[model samples]
Target: MGGNGKHRWKISFHRPSSSSSSSKMEANHHNHHKQQEEPPKDFLCPIYGALMADPVVVSSGQTFERLSVQLCRNLGFSPKLDDGSIPDFSAIIPNKAIKSAILHWCDSSGVVHPRVPDPATVEKLVRALMAEEEVYPSPPPFSSPQLRVSERELIRGVAENPPVTFSHAATELGPRVNHFYSSSSEESVVITADNPGTPLPFATRPLCYSSSSSSEITESETLASSIPNSAPASEEEDHLVRNLKSVDVVDQEEGVLSLRKLTRTREELRVLLCTARVLLALKPLISSRYAVVQTNAIASLVNLSLEKPNKVTIVRSGFVPYLIDVLKSGSIEAQEHVAGAIFSLALEDDNKMAIGVLGALPPLMHALVRSESERTRHDSALALYHLTLVQSNRAKLVKLNAVPTLLALAQTGSSASRVLLVLCNLAACPEGRSAMLDGNAVECLVGMLRRNELDSEATRENCVAALFALSHGSMRFRGLAREARAVEVLREIEERGSERAREKAKRMLQMMRGRDDGEDEEGDWEKALRSGGAGGVGRNLHGPNSTTF
Candidate 1:
């Protein structure tokens, strides 16, 4: 027994033939053939109504009573008998031993957990369990529906961190009092997270946060640091939601989602809500003032990335730091989700600096130090590319020691585009360009591209364009680009990108390979003139009216 006399009983499912089980059997056939084995026609327990391959296994007489209690409870009986005692499930045991044996063989106790049912079996089970005689009203009106809205709020707010006060907008919230737990607590409400995994004062009724996907705390933090006592919980949830933008992404269609159901696995709900939140937040339609609020709000979702659920649907949650930390927790799902999140984030710049701040680079770089996946290696480098775009961020990138790791990434097959971008951006900066040009990066890029290992056509173009970025604008990269097959790769890109990814790659390639043939091509004199303004780089990028980058 684990908790509350709950015994772990594996109910073997008997079927005419279960394909999943057959497949499993077929997979294990090699081992089975080597040994003498017969079909698993197991034993039956007449008392508890169970089947087993071995009679040595103990019969679960008490288990039936417990299960009956649970089923009766679910079926709207308090399972406390009409006499105010626990039901005597001995009510189910009056049959002769032979009759009991037959019942045991029938529906008494074999369950393939997580298995959905055949329509016939489902219909039969429903019909049997729901005979007209078993029909009951909703528990005799249950004391005027005594469960009030404030009590619900008290339950959830206390559950939020436990010991919740009445002031979390306690005025007549109704069932929506669960909003904070739903929206604010981002951890997927899976069984493990919502259960007694984290130490809270109350163990019988779940309270406080779930076991998070991040570093394991010796103890959970004080709730005061997390939820605010004074926030008008329900009002805040509705007011800010109207402004988010919607992009027509090619994903699962809407209306297929069942977000309203209460039992759809807590983490799944978390993932769905999180995806909804982020997909909306990214577009300009969202109010800028709510950016930080939304960002903090979604950070709570970080815990679900470690659940090993297919994060692909909710991948847009932009939980880079959370996922990265999850990977650090030594969870396989964490590593995969972190990989997925990094790959997803590099597709845009919205959360780049925040990702850099989330302490991703050090762990990512550490993983990349020896990883062989070109995909993983490439995404890691790509994330660094976005992180380096901000000047303040450049220091952290350097601190993650990504330059050397990025240089190594260029040597891998999948990293050509990322390598070119990183090298180009680095060269565009005074120190970064100096580091690449004066060192081994030039030869490394050339070697990587020429090896035929860099399969991505975009990488080929980026390599060429990076040569131009290195060679043209700054004297430092200009010297390095010429040394790194910049001319050859540029020609390749001009030919391929036109028929390939269109003008974006081609225009960039052309810009890097520009000569003094046109006014635009002659950027130096214009750039020098542009530098006379106070904004310098800022003006050169965005005009005088442009907000600070």
Candidate 2:
């Protein structure tokens, strides 16, 4: 071996360490388990997941939900959850990447929600929630579903998000929760408040003229029972007793009159509507025919929300169409309800689209114009914010020349949520932010700012951010802003923008002051929108119109 002045050698070893490999394998398995697990089911957007753990609600959508109820009624889907429910999301998701919003709720608690999947899809979720595997129960295809009445009603309630009443309130109650009523089955007994002693209209009068000792009937009994207990009286005493009994009879009549007044003060139309709503919620259990009756009854409530004392109930029923009419009608109450409904349906894409189609944007802006609360105006703006969630709907809104309204809302609307959603849509729309601005939206926004007395902190803040968004996403829109004197507005925006938005304000300042030399930011407005802003600011916009229910 040493002959060539070098030694040849080979080395070999057993397999690598099993413990190290096993530990790595275990770690991998743990990771795999984690991957398989679902994200903790949440009911709020990631932004407010911590603050609004129970649910985020608003009351500014009154105007948006009334007419849309018709659209929603036909939207024809199951209602296991709010629009945020992943609807057949296995393959297609409705852009959860934007907010990761979920409108999940236990209906037993009666929480109106937004952006939930349509009823058809929610049925699956309800079935799954109930731990029921789909059982294609069939004698063959096209057979009658031997569904129990309760099961059918249950499905109707869960899938369609229809009203329902429980046997003993299986559903729980919450601060924001409200219960529905069924009209047909509820016993509408008319109690006499004026007179407790007098016989009811349904009761009979006793015939005993004289019962020297028993003429005074102490206990309640049918007139028939009292007749049997009466004793025969002598002639002289009978006449004298008759006079005494007459006084008692007159007293009884007075008591009855007083009782009648106290009992059913009166069933006003509003109370009737409220009663109908409650009864309607009881659903098919009350009567098979009632389901059909309730639809009309509930639709009437939209006309009633603006009334005193009963308007509070509208907060409970931010349901579609009923409330949308009010929103579209341009009533202050409608705007409030629309805002509330927006929060209710914020988690739903269909709801947003439906409310939008119901002409919510216009009224929303009007509401913001005379808003009493900063939050109310913000919610009104948010209604518009919610409307643009659907891409096609947003496009339709653009075609309607709605950008001006939304821009106005953002500029003079919510300080915090000023451009939160409108911008998202403008960015999402086929119309680039620049295109939106070209439609005179920048002028409209700047106009809002110009009209302001500059007293409202929220309003000023909102205006600045809205301008920033206009210029931020689309160079064309930004240039248009400059033309509209939006640069001047930007100074105001700079004065009001959040700490995070200051750099943007500075950049706009440079651009507006004509300091940025040659870079063209307008050519690709769409790209700018895609980067951060969807396009411009999104906020609730209330309309000036008012419709009394």
Candidate 3:
């Protein structure tokens, strides 16, 4: 009976037509297969669970979407995985292997693939061009536009996108672009050596990415051929070429500052100086146009001026006038950069005369009196200080009514230290001494000393030096110093100061007391220095070693 029941169930399962049964079995098998299929895990980002077009790896040994990781970093959080584990962002690296695998899988599975370049091609080109033996088989010549396209592709692949990548490449490719645009001899030689008799791809044009500039190619070729490799150019030639060149000034400025920081090689210095000249020629930009370009150029020139040769070159290029113009007409930000540039340029003794003659003082005085920025005021004062080391500059400053302006700052501004240093420099001459005395500079310096509010050792030293200069030989000046309590300050400095400061202080004190080292032959001053009576000001020497103040 059980066998008969099993036979009946089997017959019920297969009682339909043969074609219908086969078709039903086939449909069931297809549905089962579809139900078992799933998307490939390797192509999915561990963080976003989406197919990754641009995959990057972090230090925790996990892969994530590039945008997801960057977003996490921007939000000030560690990159998180789908499992909620945080990965270190700073150690994030490009997962080229995974990226290539993802593209491959997309291509095989009929999914839309990202437009990233094959890294293998770029690596091959880099290797062949930079090979140890120069005998490798060269690839066929690509057009200038093709070369640009290839570089663009390389940068895009590295950056993982198109638009951001293009901007970044154009910005950071300054040195390479300069090489291709201005000196194509190397590229030309390589192309000719690879295939004899073929014209170089970069030889007949300014190697720009714009493929539609054929009309200008003839002019570019003519200019390239006419200019010699080693000839020195006149200023007019420089101006013409600079106008013709299409380099990005902001990028070039960045390169210039970087070169100055890394090395002081003459070649780099020459390039930097040349860049400064070009920027100086574009002076109108410093006033109101291209704020980024103007600020970067100013900063680059400031850093380059730290080197003596660069400073000399920039000064000779007539940059002082541009800086002065900016100080007069630019935005406050630009004025600050110009002030800093002027201060750096003032370090060169030879630059002081040029700066003074070029009308730097009026803008500087304006900045000192009216600018709300303390840094601007400080830098202007410092430049004035360095410039006043030249006697004629001091006279010019006096004529500009600098004494009263600086005295006001010293009495009530945040730039008191810089003002006092300027006063010290001006006090080096007879006219400056009279100016300080009339402007009551002694009282200001004395107030600073008594309150212990001097900003730095340099400020204090300059203050003491100014006092010494003001009161060294004249009885009336000595009385002024004495009444202003200069002796008390000098004693304090002598007891605990730098070696040079102490020596200067002691000399000034001895001079104020009307005694010479020759008269104090027994080292009585040593005994006085140890004594604390009236802060060492009441020490009496009336016999052979003394005269009176």
Candidate 4:
């Protein structure tokens, strides 16, 4: 059992047979005839129990049908092995050798095999499952009121061992809380209510309040009044809201934690990435007044957004503005969560500019400038790093005074690598490089190299690239690079760094000595001038912005 006693049952789905499977079977039958021998179990698909076609191997060293594994993934479940461990779909490799072996067996046996359903039909079934039309509720007040067998068993267990308050137990049961009935104009006054019984497992007596009207006392107030409390009306409402919100917060937290833990399991993470329940539930709660609730919700969204499928889901939900609002007014912890969520979503190439268009930079700059938490500062810079990857986003970020802020962070903050990457991106533009030079970024670059606080080759590569840009700007800049003992560092990098780094270092060294290394540096310098500026040369240099999640 996991959080809230909710067990994540594996989704059961049958694989669709494809034309490929059928053709292979038919081809085997048309071959040589001989006495049939039993096919090895390894040659059979674990799900369909048939001769394997397009077999694939997983990390667990077990092979299964490709279509079957894909079907299981589409069903939001992992292929469960006999040992009960579910392997991630990405870890599964196509086993062409096993497939060939199965083909040989089928040809030698000359036995007729059943025609499997077309692979296209199987794919359609998978798409339907992925769309979740039949599994989960589409709208509120689900038509199918009956629960799953597992859910019903859990509910019956609760009914048999009833809680002290039937209302509390009813609340505990995971039923959709529809406001439809409560919001209706119809008012049915109960004369008297029955006690706990067989059919109605538990009953509740309405709170004895004077009959004013539904307008005077809201449903939540009525619920609060039913509980034994001696506070004034205002206090009662607050108490009720706090209790309700607390309960909601707990449920949301459990769901968030479940998603978090599910990410550790490859197959479970795939399902979580595709499932919309957590995203839908958390989106509405980002505006929650409670800091803890908003933080947990944003944290969950951040985790989900790390996956490609979930990243699009989050961005499409129109959450960037909401997240920006949280950054504006949320607590430090909430701001950190919001920043992480933003960057995770921005990983998608399409979302890079959308985040900038939504005005995410202001709050991000705010966090970068004033946040007391180093982690918050780092996260803000990281988010800005991804957002600035696009040309338009880079302009927006620099226009918002992001360059100076990032430079300041690089100088004294713990986010040296994050700030360095963003600086690297901005350095590709003329105005960005000028801003770096004006912000004394060369000194910070030198200090970073000297201090070696962050032992990352990527960071050093970025620093060298920035210095190279500044060194080419003017004689004074070249003098500054030399004063920072850049020559020694460049020599070491030219000797010890990667091939690209060595090439860049050699150019920088030749430039410092008032000599042209060759036509290569001349073309590069002209290209940098024409293209605005240069980025880090090493492949691993300044890879995607660092993220805490």
Best by TM-score: 4
Instruction: Give stretches of model 1 more than 4 Å off.
Output: 1-322, 342-350, 371-379, 448-453, 477-549
lDDT of 1 by residue, 406-450 (tens): 776666534445455655566555566556655567666656556
What tens digits encode model 4's per-residue C-alpha lDDT throughout 1-549? 011112232222233344544577676763332213556767766555556657776433356677766665544443333433333343456676677787776666554442443577555543443343234322322211222223334445545764232222112112222121211111122221221110110001000100223344333334434544332345533332233223344544444443333332232243334433234344556887655556656765665565565655566445677788888888876776677677657666667765776677888888877876555665677677667777877777777777777877666666565577677778766677777777777777777766766445545555666666565545566777877787787788789865445667888888888886444664685464333222222222112221222
Residues 61-111 of candidate 2 have per-residue lDDT tens digits of: 222111122222222311122321111110111232222232233232223
Tens-place lDDT per residue, model 3, 150-173, is 333443453563222122222321
lDDT of each: 0.36, 0.37, 0.51, 0.54
Per-model TM against the reference: 0.36, 0.36, 0.46, 0.47
Q: Model 2: residues >4 Å from true position, as ranges? A: 1-339, 347-380, 387-393, 407-435, 447-452, 485-502, 512-549
Steric clash pairs (candidate 4): 17-117, 17-118, 17-119, 18-118, 18-119
Model 4, position 431, has a per-residue lDDT of: 70
Measured with C-alpha atoms, the lDDT of residue 490 in candidate 2 is 58
Best by lDDT: 4
Better of 1 and 3 by TM-score: 3
Deviation in angstroms for 65 in model 4?
48
Candidate 3: deviation at residue 311, Å?
2.3
lDDT sort, best first: 4, 3, 2, 1
Off by over 4 Å in 3: 1-284, 516-549
Tell me the lDDT of model 1 at 322. 39
